[model samples]
Target: MSGIYIHIPFCKQACHYCDFHFSTSMKKKEEMVLAIAKEIQMRKSEFKNEIVETIYFGGGTPSVLTSAEINFLIAEVYKYYSVSDNPEITLEANPDDLSSERIIELSKSKINRLSIGIQSFFEDDLQLMNRAHNSAEARKCLEVATQYFDNISLDLIYGIPDSSQNGEQAQQMSNEKWKQNIETALSFGIPHISSYALTVEPKTALNKLIQTGKIAAPKDDVAQEHFAILIEMLEANDFIHYELSNFGKENYFSKNNSAYWLGKKYIGIGPSAHSYDGVSRSWNVSNNALYLKSIQEGKIPNEIEILSVMDRYNEYVMTGLRTIWGVSLDKIESEFGSGYLEYLNNQSRKFLDDDLLFIENGILKPTKKGKFLTDGIASDLFILN
Candidate 1:
């Protein structure tokens, strides 16, 4: 089954660590919503034959849109595409936007899932990341949201660097405090979590802060230690480490995200959104104004690349290794040729010997030790062309 990812490219305010395409201006919100709907209509033919099983409202912050605006978009999807009877419609939101009334309103809408961004449960961490929501709002939103929605996912950012102390970098969160954050999230009774490390992307305020010594850079050793604690704590509480950074309880894996890892086709809507067909991948222009202008002109503002066999293999290896599904060695041999298969085996030999990777029932997967480092390991196994 395929999916459609709609990028809402507006935010209430800019987060320092975010490099995602977004405008802090709400001036173009109305025009953008119209453009997005029109684009959905324009791209229906692309997914004409595939059943749209997932409709994901992602990025800069979907909850910024009113429920009616959101409903209008979902209506457009149903109008043009052959959607499944029960499509997984998810809206990525921030805690500040999810007030009790807002939560109730969202629960009544077509959005069956909420991925709330709760970077941290402490005020200092919130201030450091410049998150739109505070520690109290984060907890309150979850408490109320859980009452309205059963299928909810909360985001947590780990490995955040603390303030410089005595001319040395300190950890923002002690292990005990991190555990408290986890416990607080669990207390909300949310079924899913999409946790990630705080990476300082280039050109982001985070990078500049680090360079200017306004903030300490995140330590890899500290991050790894946190990651280990995350896995052990979550798994002990019956949460499956389905993806490298995702933990879900039974029957709660993110269908939209899972579809992506399984190499399913999806059409990405809005600026800076990426789409994938089996043989090619495409992404829209990152500029919102350009996207709106092009969409208004009945043209999709996007670029496409026809995937080489090597490109496809590399992508599959990268994505597959991150999830529990793993990469199928037999499928690799069958689809990419025996030479590619042999190359993978040879490249993976050292990792397998190191117990960082292993083969079971023809599927190659990362070990617990290697799961945290899956991205690095997957790169080592890639066939460079």
Candidate 2:
């Protein structure tokens, strides 16, 4: 099975911390949409042998589009690709876009899942991040959204200065405030949550603010502490930490993300989108105007790289170590041959000895002590060529 990802590269406003490819202007929105549809049709043959199990509309903010516009894209997918009987269609939305009427409209549409960008439940943090939605809008949207959709995921930002740092007295207050955010989300009974630390990426407004002393940089230790709190709280509420940064109740884990991690093929449509075909990886040009022009000229403006054996093994190691599905020894031996398997066994010994990783049922998994450091651990296990 495969998945189709449609990237909507337009946003209502720019968030300070975000570095994703997007435009705040709506000048080229219509043209971009049409180009995406054309691109989808153009790439249909790429997945000819596979059935699409998921269709994800990710972006700067998919909710910026009208319901009719969203339906038009979905229709384009159905027209060209072979989709599964009950494909999980997810739309990444923001709180300001999900008004009562909009929620009702979406509930009647083909979108089965909604990934709301509710970065924080506090006014200060929202302001800090320059999110389009205020605290009230954040809560109100979730209240209305829960009535229409059970399969919802909310994005929360941790490690903000107000919520995850400072001296002992300040830390206590921050913990309480952070706890309230989690408890508030729990009160809404959200099934899935995707949370992350506020990393100041280069060329972002947040990084500049930090440089100018307008905002403090996020501390890694503080983020780690907040992550621990998050895991403990969610697990107590019956949510499984399926992925390092994702928690879900029972079967509510993200199917699209799971497919990607399992190395299933997926085609990404629109500017800045990416695609994987098990042997090669490609990404479209990040410029909206350039992308539209290229598609109009009947060409896919993208870069592709053929994966070597070491590349595939390293990717598997990176993705597998981040989820509940640990790295499989037998699969490595069978797929990558005994040399890679031997290398893995030799390299993993230190982590095992340190109790950071353990093998059970022939699968290597990070222990609780090593969960927060999975990326580093995974990198250490990489088969360097």
Candidate 3:
């Protein structure tokens, strides 16, 4: 089974910490949607051998579009692709855009899942991130959304400047408030949550603010503490810490993301979207105007990279180490031959001895201590060719 990812590269406003490709303008929104649908139809042969089990509307902010526009795109996928009878279609939304009427409308559509960008329930944190939604709207939208959609995932951001940091005292989100944010989200009874630490990427508003001393940078130690709190609270509440950043209750794990982590093929449509077919990876241009122009000319504006043996192996190790499934030693041996298997075994010795990693039933997984540093551990296991 495979998946289709459609990127809606438009946002109502830019979040201070965001570095994703998106425009705050809706001038080209209609043209972009049409291009995305055309690109989906054009790339049908890419996944001709596979049945689509998931269709993900990732973004900019998918909620910016009307329900009719979303359904139109879904219809295009149905027309050109062999979709599973019960495909999981998810839409990424921001709280401000998900009004009561919008939620009701979305529920009637084919979209079954909602990934709300709640970020935080605290007003100060929301302002710090420059999120379009206020604290009231954040809670209000979820209250309304959960009633209409059961398979919902709320995104939360931790690691903002706290009282200890030298930022605007009014904007500081204390540890106690952070815990309250977690508790508030739990009170919603949502099935899935995708939490992430506040990161400052270069060229982002947050980065420039920090550089100009207008805002304090996010502290790594603080983020680690927040992450610990998240895991402890979620696990205590019966949520499975399935992946590093994702937690789901039982079978509610995101199929679209899970398919990617499991190395299933998926086609990404729209500007700045990335795709993979077992051996090669491709990404569309990030420029909206250029993407539309190329697609209008019946050409897909993208770059492709053919994966080498080492590239594929490194990716497997990287993605596998971050999830509950872990990396399979037998698959490594069968797929990459004995030489790579031996290399992995030798490279994993130090981490295994340090109790950071463990092997159970031929699956190598990161221990709780190693989960926070899975990327570093995965890098150590990479085979440099």
Q: Which stretches of candidate 2 lie over 4 Å from their true place?
A: 163-173
Taken over the whole model, the C-alpha lDDT of each candidate is 0.92, 0.92, 0.92
Sort order, TM-score high to low: 1, 3, 2
Candidate 3 lDDT at 7 equals 94
How do the residues 135-234 of candidate 1 rate in per-residue lDDT, one tens digit apiece?
A: 8999889889888899999999888887536336655567787788899989888889889989989989989988987788888887888899999989
Better of 1 and 2 by TM-score: 1
Q: Over the stretch 117-147, how does candidate 2's per-residue lDDT look in tens digits?
A: 9988998888878999999999999999999
The residue pairs found clashing in candidate 3 are: none
Instruction: Score residue 57 of candidate 1 by CA lDDT.
Output: 99
Worst 10 residues of 1 by lDDT: 163-172
Total backbone collisions for each predicted model: 0, 0, 0
Q: C-alpha displacement of 116 in model 2, angstroms?
A: 0.4
Shift of residue 130 alpha carbon in model 3, Å: 0.7
